[model samples]
Every structure is written in C-alpha cells, then in structure tokens.
Target: MDNKTFSLQTDLALYCRTGLYEPQTSIQEHTFHYRRLVYNVIKDTLRRAFPMTRKLIGKRRWKKMVMHFFEYHKCQTPQVWKLPQEFSDYYQQVNFPFKKKFSFLVTLLQYEWLEIEVFMMEDLPIDEFSIEKKSQEDRIIPNPEIKILSTEYPVHLKNGKEITEEDKGQYFVSVHRDFYTKQIQFNDLSYPFVEIILKANEGCFSRKDFIELLAKYDSDREKIMKLYQDFEQFALQNTIFLGYQI
Candidate 1:
C-alpha cells in the first residue's frame, strides 16, 4: 500500500480496536479482532495497577466498569502509563448505589497512587539554595513528598468502604517514598510536627519560630521534644532526613 493508504488503514484499525464500533466497510473483521486484543491489554493493565480497586468492586462489577471505560474513553496520550489514574478517575465518577462510600475509595486510590508516584521519585540532593533552616525560632517547609496531612482524620478504608464520621479524624499518616516503593506509615506526634514545620512561612525559620509553631498547636514542650528526637533518629535510619546540605 502507498504511505497514505497505510496510514489510513492503521488509524482505522486503531479506532476499531479502541472499542468504537465502526462499520467494517472501510475496515474488516481483522480490525475488530485487533480491537478486542487492545481491550484485553488495557483491561489487564488496569487490573494490575488497581488490584485493590478491582477487589473493592468485586470481579463482575470491576469487569463491567473496565468494559464501560474502554467503550467510552479514548485514552490518546503517548504516556499510556497514566491509564491507571484515568481508571481511578472513572471509578470516582460512577455512582453505584452500593458505592456510596466512593469518597473513601477515591481517597484511598488517590493515596495509593501517590505512594507509587513518590516511590518512583529520584533523589534530588537536598537543595543548597537554602530555605533558611529553622532555628530555635523558625518555621519548616512541608516536604513535597508529604501528601495529605491533616490535623484530624487519617483517611482509611474498611472492606473498601470509607469509615463514617463516628470514626473519622482519629488518626494521621505520612506517606513517603523509600528507595523504590511508596510506603505509608502511621504518624507519631513527630510526623505531624514535621508537617507543621513545612507549613511555616516560605522562608527560613528560626529555632524560636519552630518552637513557637509547636506551641501554637499546644504541642507539649517536653513530649514534643522527645517525639522530635525519636523522629529525627527514625528519619536518619530511613534515609528520609537527608541532613540539610546547606
């Protein structure tokens, strides 16, 4: 075939493979078969990326959701890798009466996504340009890696459902990357305090500023100090506290 004819044929095949039921007048049965193969590839990709999501919805529903997604959305990005996020987004939009707890499922999936994203982050040597290190009176910068820090509520899901208000705001978690995997662990007082440090004004923070930030939150001096010490040690061990390069 000429280049033009080849390109036209390829595009037609891709369109059919993407679940758009185009008439075979311009294409052929082979085009539909090609489309089915594409659907399976996409489905398996989603399934691997979201085991929890699949399990949450169960096999039958999950299959239905994936099928519906394939039928409707033409994911045209060169970064085909982002298909998982798109799937998660679709899950959030679906209003299954049984899925009234989607709010929690969305959050959990988003959290898991962050964990994966962070784990993939390459270590940038701590910036030497300096954000003015907090002293006995300075603020701290929230690390970009810290996603979803809240004063109340550590978001979680139970059997794929979000726990309701009665159990809400009872815990906090700090999600961070460790080498190659995104890891999430419950936050101790120190983790939240690290969050507080990040929340400080955009410049250097002094020791006094740091101390005051803690005090503003009514973080007990003795207790927080102990927590801080323990936390610093933990960060060092985990390679997360990369000592200020400044």
Candidate 2:
C-alpha cells in the first residue's frame, strides 16, 4: 500500500523465493505462492537453455544449482530466455558442484546457451544469392547472431553423455541461427576462418587477410588459395543468409 509496505512485501517475497523464510500473513502467503511460481518459471527457462548441462549434472544437482542461482544470482536482463545466459558466469564466481569436477561445464553451458541467444537475435538477414564476392582486403559483413566459441572439449559433439578424456580435443565452433529456416546451425570452422570470423564480427579482418591468414596455415600456395575460395563461398552462401549488419 505504502512505500514501506511495498518494500517489506518485496523483501518477504524474495526471501520466500530463496527458501530463506516462510509466509507470515495472508498477503505474505500470496507473495510466497507467486514467489514459488516465479522461481519455477525461471527454473524452467534455464532448463530449456542449458539442457545438456542439466543432463550432464542430473536433476537433483541441477535443481540444487538452480535454487542456488535463484537465491544468489542477480539477473541483469529482464528477458526470461536471457536469464540462463548468466549461469556460467555465476558458476565461475561461485564454487559449487561444478567448481572443478566438470571441466567442460562452463563451455558446455555456453555452447548450449548460444542456440537460444542466436535464435532470439534481431539481424539484418541478407540473402546468399544477393551477396557479392569481395576481395580479401575488403571488410565483409558477417551474420550478427554468429558466435565463435573455442574450447578444449568437443562441445559441438556433446550428446548429453558425461565427459571423458576422449572428448578432450580442442575445437572451434560457430553457432548461428539461419535466416531462411530460422534454425540454429553448427559449423566447425577452421583456423584462419575462425580467426577471420571473430575479427570480422568486430568490424575488422578483411578478405585479403582472410586468405593470407589461411595461407599461413598451409605452405602450398594453390591449396591455401583454394581453401580461401571455399571459405569465401560458404560465407557468401550460408553466412550471408543470416545477413550482415555492418
């Protein structure tokens, strides 16, 4: 009703959500009900966002971590889907079940979350057929939703199974949401291409350097140039579909 009343009510609701305190009054009981409701909603949102992480950890541990996140983590974004985007950050800051046991936990969370993040992005949506081939020195536009991720584990090959030594190979993964199908796509990008895309996204890494960088990967000039052609072709065909903003 008043400022003090609202503040107390808010605090009480938060406490209930955190499982720190129970409702004391009729209104507080309603607050508790809504608090639990909101907690479950946020939990479900995170569960969808990090399905692989949840699978890796199991329901009990995942629920416990979710509760911990619910109690201690402060969400910066108002959007529900973006809530789990901070889970990895919180996990890193807070030493919990995944403190050191799960080496790929944070990276796996990121790889999984990228699907949701990219799918929700608002991009310019350039068509592949309309995109023109540009020289290596020219700055080429890249898909806005594309995220370049590098990790020791083959996070791209994650199939909900627990991690082992065999999954320890380093990988460069590009996850983007396709404009035509609006489906999330995974591309295992090569060395120079990965570097080029990462820099290109930042408004750097022209086509000339794109080929030059690839050339460094191989001593054979003709083979390296061919790789450049294929790389540029893929970008023009698929990546352009996500369209370029800058």
Candidate 3:
C-alpha cells in the first residue's frame, strides 16, 4: 500500500482505540460504526481473558480500565488470546488510578494470564524414558509447559477483594499443563521446593543434587534424603517431573 493509505489506516486504528480522531465528513458515519465495532471486540476479548480481575474490581471500574488500556497502550501481539498478557504488562508499567486501591492487581493479572498461557501453550516433545528405571544419578526432566510464579499476595489462593495485609507474604506457585490430560493445574509450593523446580529448569538436577540443595536449608542428612524421596513421589504423581532423562 502507498504511504498515504498506510498512514490513513494507522490513524484510523489509533482513532478507533482512543476515540480522539474525527474523519472526513464523507466517511464520519461509517467510521463511527466501525470504531464502535472495534471497541466492542476489544472489550469483550479482554473481559473473557480477565474474568477474575473483573469480578474483583466491579464492572464499571473494569470498563474504565479497559478503556485506559485501549487508549494508552499500543498492544504488540496480533493474537487475540495473547492480548491479556500484553494488558498485564501494560498494567504494571502504567500508573492506573485503581493501582493504589489494588496493590495486588498486577500479580492477580499475571496469575490469571498464566492459566490461559498454560492452557494454550504448544506441546513439547517427550523423550522415551521409564519412571521405573529412575535413579539418583539420572538427571530429572521437568514438564516443558510449566511456569513458576512468585507473588507477595496469595493471588493464587485468594481473590483480590479477599486479600488483606495479613495475607501479604512470599508465595510460590507452579502452573503447569498435565502431560497426558492437557489440563492446567496449580500447585502451592514452599520456598525450597520452588528453588528446586527453578534449578531443575536451568538443567535437570539429579536426586543427589536435590538432596544437596535441600541440605542447605536443613543440615540433617537423613531428613534431607527423606525429603528428596517425598519430592520424587510428589513430582511423579503430579507430572511435575516427567521422567529421568536418558
């Protein structure tokens, strides 16, 4: 397309998003109708993406927030489903009016967006390895489609309105898509366990490595060994650890 046509299209998009531009008298009526349609599409898509956030903030406030995002933020992703992630990013960087009232808003947005992310993420290749043959020396294999989130608010446990000052503390959560079921799952994790999963992601850790890591928190060798065993059992049950890598 020519530069003038491209520029016109770009201006139209900005006008639609911000409701600040007036087109030529000849096309004003059609432009108004098209802008309304565009706004509705964006509003509806964001509403579905952040249902929990909307519930916590009320409809009127949610509408205003959506408008703020539409007007001020230039979204990077073309995919409709990925827009929520962009919105979350925008929420963190921009100073929204409701931010003071809802300090945990960004964390809540992240928590909600991650569920969609895990649900829509593409599948990863699974290597042929037997759980029965797993050994301490074997490097662990973590589920590829997983995310670890750390938040000061228990956004994972409590809704935004329900969260209070008392509930503000360090919290770790593992969000993963089950390998066989393709279902998204959330697991609350302690600090040490969170560390183990993070380290495992860097490069799969062996059982011995897991023990030594846990030993840092507790000096009891026997207790550390037992904890590692328990972790292995839990990881296998939840598909957190897919299997031992060959």
| Highest-lDDT candidate | 3
- Give Cα distance to truth, residue 165, candidate 3, Å: 0.9
| Top TM-score hit | 3
Query: How would you order the candidates by lDDT, starting with the best?
Result: 3, 2, 1
Q: Quote model 1's TM-score.
A: 0.69
lDDT of 1 by residue, 1-246 (tens): 799878766576557545554544455656567667778788877777777767766788778788778776666554555777777777777675556544466665665565555555565433443333444333232234544434343344354544555655544455655422446443434446565445532444434454555665566898656665665456545534433324
Candidate structures ordered by TM-score, highest first:
3, 2, 1
Off by over 4 Å in 2: 1-6, 21-29, 124-129, 132-140, 160-162, 202-209, 240-246
Model 3 ranges with Cα > 4 A deviation? 24-29
Expressed as tens digits, the lDDT of each residue in 1-246 for candidate 3 is 999788887888888887777555456668777678977888988898898899999988898888888887887878888999988898898877778898888898999999999999887776665676445698888877889999999988876788988898999999999987989899999989988888887776788888899999999999989988998889888998888887
**Global lDDT scores for all candidate models:** 0.56, 0.73, 0.86
lDDT of 2 by residue, 38-73 (tens): 888988888778877887888988988988888887
- Superpose all Cα atoms of candidate 3 onto the true structure and report the RMSD in Å to 1 decimal: 2.1
What are the runs in model 1 whose C-alpha is more than 4 Å off? 1-20, 23-29, 101-103, 122-125, 128-146, 149-165, 179-191, 197-209
C-alpha lDDT (0 to 100) for residue 42 of candidate 3: 83
TM-score of each: 0.69, 0.81, 0.91
